[model samples]
Target: MSLWKNRNFLLLLGGQGVSEFGSSITYVAMPLVALTVLDASSFEVGVLTAMSSLAFLLISLPAGVVVDRSARKKLMLWSNVGRAALVGVVPLLAALDALEMVHLYVVAFFVGVLTVLFEIAYQSFVPSVVTKDQLVDANGKLSTTQSLSVVLGPPLGGGLVALMGATRVMAVDALSYLVSVVSLLLLPMREEPPAKTAGFSWDAVRRETAEGLSFVFGHPVLRKVVACTATSNFFGAMYFALEMVFFVKELNAGPLLIGLAISAGGAGGVLGGLTARRVSTRVGSARMIWVSVLGLGWTGVLVPLAGPGWGFALIAVGLFGFSLSAVLYNTAQVSYRQAVCPPELLGRVNASVRWVVWGTLPVGALVAGWLATSLGVRETLLVAGAGGWLAGLWVYFSPIRGMRDVPTTEPVTA
Candidate 1:
């Protein structure tokens, strides 16, 4: 069955696309808002970012439990509404000429909390709307949309910010969340059954969390996938933390060049996401994942070497996007995980895996910051690139490399 033939999936995708594009806008607008309008110090900008991520770390597990016990659609709707309300404050404050860095930080924190809830619900809901066979395709399609938003979002966001001013541009983001809420309400899927243990208890939650962790760690394929992904994220975070410094100092790039280089990667990601399914079918999922890792790892290697010219940097960034392995890896891994996990365990399992995978980001960011301060920007990037490449070896040497096809039945425990 063609992916487009599924009405509910289309709605979900459309709604999410709107919301993600808005998020893309905020990605640019927020820093600019803090930096230019509020005159936020570098430390304050860093604090705002750290606070937002801290919300994700703090809220993900509890949000998983709530998602498991609630109607997934309702969770999505309310989360969108909540995010809309949180983001709206920026514009309101701007209108009053009362916007402050503290206000932005608080709003960012609130939005971050809502995003965590939405993401937990969103990941858990995918399996319910699409068939097992369609899982990879669905994820691929979603990735494509997300990549498109990344490609379009920043520039569109910059334009909106430029035309309407930063505070007013946030209204576009708020509207997207409202659109998402409406689309979610229109989805036709049956409500998921509540968790068997409905009442919240610390012991029960802890046990559920433990079970999710065990499932991921206990499975041979999942274990290797998580290890490789987590390591890659750590090194990738380092590269990102140092990217601006590398661009300014090493490449002697200006804002226009930086924007062009970043946009090229987004374009590559869109192309890669679109081709994920075809590539997986031709090369096999496991091999495709290995290829993606290598591609991504090499992007890290190539960036620092791209030199001072805008042309060289643009090519390097585009190749960097093209080389991303996560689009395929996620498409395959999400399908594999959803198929193997029991229905009741889906939320926690998804959350557990994310907690481990994304949990490394903050540490990586901090380490990169420290390293950049001590080792210099170019040297830091080189370390990140080399480390990312070495991390790919986890997939290369593991049993995951031998799995030629996704299993149709429950994965056997090793």
Candidate 2:
């Protein structure tokens, strides 16, 4: 069946799209609110950005346990509701002239916690909505909108910020969550059977978390893919942390050009989503995983080559290539993971991958900051560009290197 005809999938896609669009708006507005209203310094803004990813490292293992045990749809609904309330507080505090940087910090941290819960459940829940064969198409459709939201959300956010205030713009973000909640409520219940446990206990949580980590590392293909993703994310985070600073200070790019360059990444993501299934089918899914990175990922090297005048296009092209390869790699690998993991362990397995991969982001951002101070922004980008391309060698050297298509069924257990 065509995903366009799948009503439940459509609801899930729409809800997530609305939610993603809102988050992208906050991505722009949150830092601006801190910088303009709370008078935050550049260091403080960096800390604020780091706060959002901190929960992934801290609670992702426990979150996997929660997703495996609970109703994923229910968890998603509450996660959205919680995010809405947390984001809504910003504008309310601003109106009362009581908003502080500390308030933003707390909100950002707690919101990150909810996001961890939502994402794990979201990935685990997809299988229940579609058949095993539809996983790629479903994920690709979801990715398309996610990329589209990133493309459109920021410009709308900047405009809304100009017309209404950064704090007020957050109100719109909060409202987007409500839209997600409504869409989620409209969907029918998921078809997957609930996972049974020996009941909840601290010991059980510890054991379950360990099981998740073990499952990911024990699988031959999963281990290598996770390593590649982690390495790529680590350096990718570094590249992004310095990208804007490099453009403004080194390339002398104004706001208009800067926005255009950032938008190029979103455009590339859109293309990747639209093309992933076709590309994977042509290139073979297993082969495409390594091919996407080794083939297209090296374009990040173009970024450090950017300069004044016509040279600014290098930044745009580089970001476009990086985003394109990332979305392609992610779509293929996520589908493979979903197909190969045991049903009961899906939540835990997905969380384990995210924990390791996303855990590196904040660390990489901090490293980028130090590198920029030590080696200079342009030179730091050179390190990031080369490092990102090399990261793909993890899968290249592993068992997946020779395979054409990946297995769609869980590995047989003893």
RMSD of each: 2.6, 2.1
Q: Compose the digit string of candidate 2's lDDT tens values, residues 73-173.
A: 99999999999999999999999999999999899889999999999999999998998888887888888898888778866776777678889999988
Q: Give the Å shift of residue 283 in candidate 1.
A: 1.1
Name model 2 segments beyond 4 Å from true: 191-193, 247-257, 410-414
lDDT of 1 by residue, 43-120 (tens): 455466656665656766766777787888898899899999999999999999999988987897788788777887
Q: Clashes in candidate 1: how many?
A: 1
Best by lDDT: 2
Error of 1 at 287 (Å): 2.8
Evaluated against the true structure, the overall lDDT of model 2 is 0.85
* TM-score, predicted candidate 1 vs. hidden true structure: 0.90
